[model samples]
Target: MYSALKAGFLALPYLSLGALAALDGHCPPLGPVLPAPTQPSKHEAVPAAAAALRGIIDQVTATYNGSAVAIGVKSIHESKLLFEYAHTPANKEKRGAQKVDSDTVFRLGSLTKVFPVLALLKLKDRGVRLDDPITKYVPELRGLKKQAREDSPVWVVDWDEVTLGALASHMAGIPSDLITDIAPFGNLSAYGYPPANTSRMLGCSGFFGTAPCNKTAVAFFEHYGQRPPAQVPFSSQTVYSNIAFPILSFAVEAITKRPFAEFVTNEIWKPSKMTRSFTTKPDDALGFIPPKDIWWDANLGFEGPEGGYFSTINDLHRFFDAILLNKLLPPAQTRKWLKPVTATSSTGLLIGQPWEIFRAENVTSDGRMIEIYTKTGDLIAYHSILVLIPDYDLVATMLLAGPEVSGSAMTLMLSRIIQTLLPAVEQAGKAEARAAYGGTYVDKATNSSITLSLSDDGPGFSISRYVIRGVDVPSTDPGSTLPPATPPRLDPPMRYRLYPATANSGRQTSWRAVGTRGTAAQVDKADAQIVWPMASCLTWAMMDRVTYNMGARDHFVFDVERGKVKGVEAVGYGVFMKKEC
Candidate 1:
């Protein structure tokens, strides 16, 4: 397996740092922060943050109507479990309910969607392309017929044009679900609805309390292949579809010649060390299965890839850790996999292959926002949330089970925890930065110096003073009107901010300083054309704008030994400076 993966994906074209820079506006490159070697790592044990979080958890669980709520948080890169909390309702406790813990298992619902994507990505080793059409694998879907919809005009859905990539990203324009859930078979007569308008969709699985609704790949194509297009294939509109992952799973089985569940267990679950996770419902009593719940035993059949998997908070943390640590796939593929494929209606939300990404604001002291990659799952009585903050190398998981459990309630609990946790994370990161990188650096031969310090008003280090060759670099601007390259002259000093550029991070850490200045348009125009002009607070537009000798004038490379900052090399000026403080 290692040889196959090395030959397949490791040889694929690498996504350069330039590709990541393209997402500068959405997710600013802050680079992954490493733990300090000499100092005790705050992420290893954030006692204050944990204590505050426990308070919030207790407050939430006090009013929680569910039988159990289990939450876990970890530092993905460090592989450290930061915090864990569990709660069981008092009434359920009196009735002898099982104790809830981080290891308590609960249904994963749509979070199972992410596993199919990972499976397909690994199948890339066998020459499977994401752009390959579904018909290429499942030939039964070749001659699909179009049907008319009651809401829209008759439109033919060209199934041949739909690619696996589109399906995974929610861009395939497929129906949300073939059966519309078990609502059609529900008791609509009690709600004054006529039986003529409602009927159970054959081959569509639900909580019907019948035998397992297992349908083969052929049956799925026969029932859903001819359905009318939800929209045009590959349109900009994102339509949530449970039908997509099943198709992906079918393609997986077709390509691997193995059952989807078996392949996932061998390739993903076992490898990630998710011991309690399962595609098929376990017959044991370990799971938090509420008594007399019909939906608990309802088999999802072919739809297992979409919303049928069960996992514990501990298992989910392990899975995310595996992804972040590059245990399952190569680092490049993992980075590419975690990114968004398309934008959604909301500015803060985005759609990945199977991830429902959200961008959080005001996460730091400087009011800088961080992008959080997340996937939410929901079933009849179980709800789950998986959060990945790549910026901080953090992962948080929440699993809830019981009749009173809800998606909104779970979301609220997670939000409160994050709101409390981020401040502590930011404080710790700042402390580490100050200890390692914050101080004055001097070149004794040239009598040049640069002082860097952390500020409460910004995200990265601020250059308080910079002197190079007896010329104040921060207070001088290279005259653009000069015939060619010339020495910078005196001008008003501009504050330069330093941010981590991860692409250059390995043996030596790379950081880029962003200098803000009025753009040509902003300087010429008297009236502002936009509410927030480019010069207000957008640092991305100003980065790398001033280059000298084919290198960024503001780029700095640090020499770190065992997580201790020894010195820095000014790339553009080609000068070495030793730490003075």
Candidate 2:
């Protein structure tokens, strides 16, 4: 009986092993298990500035009815954490209350363009010049066509000669989408049509069955047999990034023989030691995928070259450090990335290769001058700002994610925050200006020469200007400021000169002025002219709020003694300036 029982036990073991084998074939292994990622240390104390930022984030979240929001700010000079806050609601039932932490990732949206620029710079380091024609890399963009109208002839253009520089600077002249004339199929999903938006099209494996988006990009190269037309003046309307991203991605893949995402991870994230940064889907639970609730279904899965990546604020700071330090690309290349390539007058800002350039003016606590380099980012449900005071080695980044907000509102909020935290920033700048210049001066206008006196007014300073020639001018008439019947044309012998009222103030000098020959009747009588005394006359006027940083010498270089002004830069309607003494 004992021998029989042992035999049964042995058979039972075999039977169980057989069943396990069957289950293995049906279920398969769970694949390689990646260990949980280490979280960043949280020992650092939150800065007081973070409190103010948290309040803003709180307000914005409540106002927008957003689910969750995260913010991160760091001082680049000290590499110190200024502020980091993530908030979500306690009740899962409430859409806006889900809590978030530093590790929580969020879709960078259009911020994905930064990676492509880095990738291109990487290739440039490998003997590829940005000025090289598109044909040099992708031969498919030969003969590109544009539909003129419903029944109109199609306009074809050669895109081969378009250079990488043009693409990077957004001067490539490509439209936002291929189909521009006809209204896009609005109800794509309802009409049984695939989501053909740029994001969806780029993410799909086979787009519209006509060609893979990547192939379509390549085909664009093949069809446009020659170079694009010669360069024209840089205009915002002339630059488009939708066509640039895929083309650049294709180039990186072609040259490196690696996926664009992988190339970025190895070249950018790894070297920067950005532990929390990722290009592909991350394994950690904290890993954030774009909120699919906003648009596409989450089950479908979506990824694209334009805006399909996730990252943390901390990781982004690390990335910025790499770019600033010239660790990923050489110094020259890094300089190229930060250098302003195109001028965006619409914003009264300059567009650099990767940075948007602007002038910030600030009064210091001690009444000094403060100028700084400022860059900002706007994405779906997120807003970011990066200001670098190179002289002070100071850099600040502000990131907010919740509900959509207008770009202007975000910029205004950032300006307010800077104002509250760094009141001394502008004061120091003003003091610097005082030391630079404090003296009386003279200036000339088209019809008359004006003498101005600058004296230390007890409370602050005062300036006065009087017309030395021409007819007496009324002080209060609205139409008195208008120029004569025939406007003075800018030509030889009839020149306009700007004289500085104060070295520190952006206002021009009183000694120089617009000059024109006028009939005696139109000229103002010397005694009849009224003199207006004001502390300082406005020279360069920008309607938008100005941000200033005291630490950086070049922050507001344009407003500085020798900064360049391509033309009279202005912001918003009715905001302007005339050369006044």
Candidate 3:
């Protein structure tokens, strides 16, 4: 049932924008939003937020007894790292264990899933379509026959029906692995299975714990694709399959006629200046290896596409920053690629192109839900998480490694940091907003003015008063001199709130005022509640409905100088309102 809802939601035009801004229309009643900050401070929240996060890291590391931990907080808006933390066990120097820092390398298990999708996207200009089936490139997969079972009709996945996009998004219905519970260096004879007569048992059954498999990309796909599917393709079910990513790499290899490693290193890592990242394990002197597992280095021949890469905090930061800033792909494609492709049964959880998105509710003073996009990677000894909060242009990265540190440590640290940092960021954002945009602007030449201010309980700046050439913009004029027999010329009251628009250039930004009017039967808190056809979400009906001379009446363009507002242009009226006391 939820699958159907997801499908319908995906069908909507501009869903990426709509889903992110779904709550923007729900404005706080005039006086009850967030309490406006009295003064805007410079990085006022960074030191305290960093301290709180460091405390969390200390607690988690002590509890888990981890050998190394690194955390980074960065702001994409300012292109700066707000805070960074690095830690190692106290007695490390006694035994000569290398200390960890932002540049230290750590294995990024399934977080490597993003690379295949990015490679495919880069090859889009080469006539590679994500909707193309796997069989189109590697035709050998078509020869895999389904098992004949008396009770089962569908015994294996129909590779013909699966597309690259579905695989990247975890909607391809592939099983997680080819061999279940088969260790890299273990014997199946103890489990009651007969000893193999050939080397197939030793070579074919090996997984992450064992040496790299000797199979080629095509052979690996043929071996894995013959298994029974976890769900039907495009069923909107998210079954995380590590093998799915390798299949995508197979597509990339077939298209480019080059090895996946070479392509990724040259195109992605090198271009983004990710110096410490590697598809294979780097030297011990270069990487931070735990004491007990110091000699643990296994090559992932086929699994390299999924859990085979190693990266550092600095490299990963550069990677995400480049992608988010549209330095890698075009802006339109980047925006579309970063959104959720399906929703899970959990109301707060959604799935993107392998992204585990969480909707954090009530994190801010205004009680606005913030959407956080995250990708977590867990391996034998290392656990890492990369979190992107698109709303505020913030990112939180956590990486941990040790025998005692489990994947839960990453989760704990991520949750704690988000809890501590978001509120601080929200406060900082509000303070900055108030300082830059909260004030009165007047056109001295024409005696026109608008008073905009932030409230303790509002989502945006509220227009308390607006005037244009002696005409009240928000008041009901209704042409008082109209003929008596004409229509009553009723004009309903409008409450205005100004929000930042998507159009931004260098030092200028565009803000639009959205006015909400009382309906015939209005329920203030139930604005999202709907009967049928979603009647309550008709905010579009009231916006830009009345335009003059191709300029929207609600449009206000702010000219910024050094991150502070200089003046606001009322585009509809062709007037510039200079900032004044």
Give the distance in Å from residue 198's predicted Cα in candidate 3 to where it truly belongs: 9.0
Better of 2 and 3 by TM-score: 3
- Tell me the tens digit of each residue's lDDT in model 3 across 1-581: 54564445334322111212223444332221332232212457856877777787777677544468888878776555677888876533233337778988888878888899999989989988888998888776655543322223256677789899899889988677653335434567887877554423335433455556544543354355445678988886678888888878888999999999899999998878889899887876667677656323756677678877888888989999889878888899898888889978888898988788988666665665567899889877778888898777777787777777778867866788878876777777777787778889999789899988867555678888888876676654222122235333235545567877767794888877765544323433343554443234433443453355788677889998887789898887788998885
lDDT of 2 by residue, 1-581 (tens): 54563344333311121111111111111110111111111212223444565676677656544444455545443364555666553322222224566666655545666777778778864688777776677765543443222221224334564677777667766544331211232455765766555522223222222223334443333322222332332445545454466677777777788887788888888998878765544553553222433311111112245555667767877877777778888876675576667766454366665456664434222222233555555444455555654433345555455434545766776665565444332233234333333222222332332222222211122223322234322221111123446433322121111222222344432221212222222222321242632111111221112222322111111122353221121111111223232
Estimate, for each residue in 1-581, the C-alpha lDDT of model 1 and write its tens digit: 43563344223321111121112211234444333222223544366878988987887678765457888877764555778898866444232237778877788889999988899999988999899998899876655452233334244556688899999999988777764444446677787766643322563465576444455443365556446778877788888888799889989999999999999999998999989898888744667765445556778777788999988998999999889879999999999998999987888899999998887665655555567888999987888889988777778999887776789988888788778886677667777778888999999898788998865455577778788877787656452222235554434445456777765465688888765433334332412443533223333443554456877677899997776788888887777789975
State the lDDT at 510 in candidate 2: 21
For model 1, what is the error of residue 490's alpha carbon versus the real structure, in angstroms, after optimal superposition? 5.4
Return the TM-score for candidate 3, rounded to 2 decimals.
Answer: 0.82
C-alpha RMSD for every candidate: 7.7, 25.9, 6.4
- Candidate 1: the clashing residue pairs are 109-307
Query: After superposing candidate 1, which stretches have Cα over 4 Å from the reference?
Result: 1-45, 91-97, 146-153, 181-200, 217-219, 479-491, 517-528, 531-542
lDDT, residue 387, candidate 1: 94
Give the runs in model 2 whose Cα sits over 4 Å from its true position.
Answer: 1-58, 62-65, 90-98, 143-154, 178-237, 287-292, 295-303, 362-392, 404-409, 422-581
Instruction: Work out the TM-score per prediction.
Output: 0.86, 0.54, 0.82
lDDT of model 1, residue 96: 26
